[model samples]
Target: MADTPNSPVVDAQLRRASVQERLGALEVEQARLRQELVSLSGELRLPGLYLTLDAAGTSALLVADAVQEVVRLVELEPLPGAPPHVAGTFIYRGSPAVAVDLAVLLGVTREPALDAHLVICKGARPVAVLVDRVRDLVEAPVLVEGTPDGDVALPWDGTGLMAGLCRTPEGIRPLLRISAVLVGSEET
Candidate 1:
């Protein structure tokens, strides 16, 4: 719609109007893309951090968004009159949080050997879980009963701490539901 010889360049008002129109169009497109993301949410799998635990040669895993950091092992100052699962406490994030032994909680053993690693979980009720080994964190797919396809699924027998199992390259690893594990523990 150039009416003058320099309409495209000389008309500062027209240039501003053109830019505004394009910006508005781009904003609408952005909103549409966000809605598309929401619609396709079911198919998109979130990255999950899986902690592989080898408690006395038995392999297990903890799967949840609760994992904060894996710090080097340190001597735990035992909480007087605390449950056997609660090993002790230490300064985490400038505050004290209870140390939990995953093996003891799962009944694998009375206490997991404090040799190398600690999984510090962050939350309102922050606590450190003791594991024999803290394996590398991987982008775990959405955990399933068995395999992705309709096949053998590990039934929740309520004897273990995991909510379900994720079939990993190593094998099917139990996904520990941290909330459930923490619930039944004696907090007194």
Candidate 2:
């Protein structure tokens, strides 16, 4: 007997082929998007891409290359005698990383949201920075010193915490100095 178009086997086969075709088209689109990202990065003259996040209601940017991963808020082991900004420590990839709350670092007294995220940063001193949410991946543009007038201001004193300020379509935001946040956490 020959399989008919309306038969269960033929219907299943047609569905499978249709799904495969859609997947192939999606793969091509993904590749095109990736190439466009690289081209945009080159045009922007950024050393690497940046990740934007909401830190205590303040918009900030972090170097994407320095970030190892972003994970959901996990229970942490308490660190006695650690700075106020230091929330606790969590194990990551067989290593313990101190979790620093960006909200506390920015002088916000409120607790982190229930759905907060931890942005694990890679460096000589690895630390997981807690943020309210991960916003988007952006290309770093030319930076200017100090906050520009009418721009969103840094919540904290900034001092060494902020590397500089950069303009985005949303407005001006602080480019956080990861090294400062890392080292400052240790010294304080």
Clashes of each: 0, 0
> Which of the numbered candidates is closest to the native, going by highest lDDT?
2
Residue-level lDDT tens digits of model 2 in 124-179: 45588999999898775544444567555557444546655666767766777676
lDDT (tens digit, per residue) of candidate 1 on 36-140: 553566332335666676554555666546788888777889888888777788888788777777667656655455565778876555577777887765566
RMSD of 1: 18.2
Question: What lDDT score belongs to each candidate, Candidate 1 first?
Answer: 0.61, 0.73
Q: Tell me the TM-score of each prediction against the true structure.
A: 0.61, 0.69
Against the correct fold, how does model 2 do in TM-score? 0.69
Superposed model 1: Cα runs more than 4 Å off:
1-47, 146-157, 184-186
Q: How does model 1 score by TM-score?
A: 0.61
Error of 1 at 153 (Å): 12
